[model samples]
Target: MPHAVKTFRPALGAGSVLLLVVAYLVVALNARFWGVVFDTTGLAGLHGAKVVAAVAAALFALTLLMLLPLSLRWTFRPGLAVVLLLSAAAAFFIGDYGAVIDRHALASVYATDAREAGEWLSLRMLAFIAAFGALPAALLWWVRIDWRSAPRELWSRLKLSALAFALLAVAAGVAGKDVASLLRNRMELRHIANPFALLAANLSYLDHARDADRPFVRIGTDARRGDVLVPSKRPVVLVLAIGESLRAASLDLNGYTRDTDVDLHPLPIVNFGRVDSCGTNTATSLPCMFSDLGRAAYDDAEAKHRENLVDVIQRAGYEVLWIDNNTGSKGLAARAKELSAAEGADPSRCNADGCHDEVLVDRLKTLLPTIRRDTVIVVHLLGSHGPAYHARYPAGFAVFQPECRTNELQTCSDAQLRNTYDNSVLYTTHVLAEIVSLLGEPSALVNRMPIEALRCRARRGHAGAGACPEPDVSPTAAVDPGIDAAMLFVSDHGESLGENGLYLHGAPYAIAPDEQTHVPMLLWASDRFAARRRLDLDCVRRGADRPLSHDHFFHSVLALADVRTAARKPALDLFAGCAPSR
Candidate 1:
């Protein structure tokens, strides 16, 4: 019995457990951040040592602050579990999107309906959740902690906190100059701080939502159609297609080496080569582009409350409708007669995965005849939306071979990902071509006019002889008796395809890369519409090379619809100088 004597050691104290947890999070769960640091810093000597020290100090400071709240025995286990779970979730998303989860990204996640969110759910995501979130959560629950009384524990933690703060202050003082410069240069490092980034983003989203929930400030109350346009003319149908995640660089229309936009080459499409988006995500850009307030003066709350492009068009006695194949138009289509392809209304163009952009075109064909008045039809396309780019187009349209088949983009090679994205753009070209054909040939309207009449009008200072009436006629009276059609295509935002190790969209607008900000905008107008309005197609083509941004969208759309409002700024309209006014 005496020989069988055993020895027992005390279990780890609460502070020691907290320290271990913090260390595990910093070193193991945050590999993404450390990798970013290593790649970006490019330091391997004493300067690197300073950075390491500074990072360590910052981590320690954070750990100590977190630990202070867990000092109470009642709060310790639950708090630790929550932190671990959140860190794991953050790690999973960082790996999945190759992006830091910011407030806008958080809002997108929240706004995503269950069916839409399911597109991203797969075996890979399930495994990630199990490994990152469930495993750590189970371990935390399984562990036992040795704790002191609340008073003694609080006192001990206060001392530890002070020491941690002192160390952080000393480290900052020692490397203040270098640390400041590093952070300033590599702003993304702030987003890489695990759990903290997630926490900050959640808080920011909550505050933004709270602020937005207030009654919206109304805008565009004075919206009306200009008297220069005849109300009794054959309906002018304007189709405004809002694309998703379409980068300008990938379009052949913009001189991309690939044939991504070959189908659009024969059409009289004016491709704006240099154009910037209002935001890097659909949720932000969709609303901002439609608002009377341009990007510079745009306020989310005010924009939400106001009548948008569709509303203004409706106000001007035009029938407005929104047909969406993407997620509902981020409240932009709320007031209009809205249709969704995802609602099982058109099963041919949709499936469990989602509907293609062509579904909207199909829907539009059915509705076109019903529209008797001047109308604005907005078609929102899920164009090139990722990481399921391959799913965006039909299988036959996957012209780019060896494309990425999975939504887990990181699982595929960069070449495969790009190919998949390009295939989506290729499909977009077909969609646009189909829409153009549906509008009928612009040449048909040209043949309808008498040659002598056109020549006389042109000789009398009218831009187009056949389309324009005599100088004695009022501008409104000069409306073409035939149907006039116009089509405008623009993306909600651009995408990032493995550029600088970043993928997807939703980076903050201020620091977003060109890959995420530069979007494609194309315009097509029937010969009758162009000639009647005296719009010079050559002038528009020349201006295509000029710099433009989403700031032009609001006024350009209004100008296209001939809507008169105080909010219409002629300087911001791309077609302002091209069109002849009374």
Candidate 2:
């Protein structure tokens, strides 16, 4: 008892410091991430304070639970450590910052006064002061015990738990502190692992521990497919070809000297300087971009079903045609033209020209003849799609000089990847141009149209090529009512391409990252489309300085397609008077 009294004071002293440091980092990391605090903003009154309290409550509880086995210091390891880190950040950002700040951007860019300095300064983003100040201090305060003498019962038991917590800190630092992703996984998978599995005599403890989230890809057996067949007014149309992993600053249409959109150079179009994607992947982007969650209001928990823009347009009495080359139906497309919606949706299959974009043109010829005056066909192009650049274009579309000659971008030189990737852009120009000629020709027979036999295509990440050609889009010839077209061209996401030691899409903390989310968006119109819609293409194309979220898609399509429904409305859509007729 005398020995215990002597050691308690210093032991409590260090424990107090440990608790404070943990609390500081937990709050600071998240607040900085959520963009809730500016460098100048004092953190005392932030919403993140509540998060800190909650985390502290949980930590205290965990510590109490851990007191059971502290002699060898076998304290909380996996669950507790992960929870502490995630809770700290999530509460800090979402609770405190709300949606006003871009925490991910600040986390990656703030320290350096180089590239993002000017733009980030506008929001007065200040995560740096929080991170540099909090992280080191917390990290240095590891739990320690100078046990010179003590009762065997208390010493052995509590020491184990203390050692456990220390080992945990080291493990976390090595793992790079990506706590948010781990929490998302928990939210995503609900089943608790069966502990009884450990009873198996030969079972590996590690395997049993990780048996919680199984069958990573759930097979959806009920896939219903059918072609979309609907009627509409004789609508002039514009089909925007979306590019994946494309940077807005790289587009020639955006005045990029790199000539990414080279083929479109001769057409009349204006490139907007600032545009951001609703989500970061084809899965996240396809649905979010065309939904009402343009600004991160997407709620999978509140989500019973995804009502996409195409659905609104079709209901508005416009013929909506969806052509896909990448991720199929991605929940959004599944809603429309599927057997469920079609009065008599076809077999949900179509063929095309060479392995490239000719598939879309070929599909269009059949559907275009059947479309009435007020029809809107969204021709989703397989433009500049990537990875195997060598296989995309036909024999000689290579205009940029020496070629990369191969695909697997990670294995090739950046220049080689750039060469091969740019060549794909060269083909994209030819394909889109041919698409323009075919769609523009009101006089030519659909069967006799030139794009029937077109060929080749390519995306992003550790798996792709990065180079692209921007379209010029100068003044072009008049557009016709029989086949009018407007275009909204954008990329689904951007890629790192081996930059800063990152080279893939779906990077963790991937709620929606700029590199993964920053995409090119161009709004171009044929003469007939501009005049008929009675729109100031310039103002609409300018897309307000106000940040646009992907959720506005439901409203945008409803407004542009002239479709009004109880589910969505004119006042709510993200856009007004978009292209491709819908």
| RMSD in order of candidates | 9.5, 15.7
Q: List the residue pairs that clash in candidate 1.
A: 454-465, 454-466
Sliding window of 10 residues with minimal summed lDDT for model 1: 457-466
Error of 2 at 348 (Å): 23
Error of 2 at 275 (Å): 1.0
lDDT of prediction 2: 0.44
Whole-model lDDT per candidate = 0.76, 0.44
User: Against the hidden reference, what TM-scores do the models get?
Assistant: 0.88, 0.51
Q: Give the per-residue lDDT of model 2 (tens digit) for 1-582.
A: 466553333333333433444444434444423332222232245433543333334333333333243222334333334434433433332322222122222222222223212322211123433344434434433444444344654555465456546545543443323333333432211111111111121133223234344432211122121122122354445464655555454455544445555445555554544566665445455556666444457543222154556655555545555665543444555545522212222323221211455556556655655655555555554444444555555555564445555433444676666656666665665556556655663322222322212111122121233543432234445444375566665666665444443343433334434555555555556655555554566667556444553454445544444454455544545455443223
Q: Write the per-residue lDDT of candidate 1 for residues 1-582, one digit (tens) a residue.
A: 468765554467788777777777777777777777777645579888777778777866775675577656787778877777777777876766767767878867877776668878778878876887678767666666777787877777878788788878877888877767777777776776786677778887776666555665555668787755555556788889889899999886676766677557557788899999998888778888988777888766567667777777777788888888887878887877888855655666766678888887777667776667888888888898887898898876766667899888879998899889988987787788778767765322222334333234322221232344533322222334356788999998999998977898987777789989999999999887776566788988888888999989988888777777777888888987777533
Give lDDT for model 1.
0.76
Clashes of each: 2, 69
- Residue 532 CA error for candidate 2 (Å)? 2.3
Q: By summed lDDT, which 10 consecutive residues of candidate 2 come out lowest?
A: 189-198
Q: What is the lDDT of residue 290 in candidate 2?
A: 65
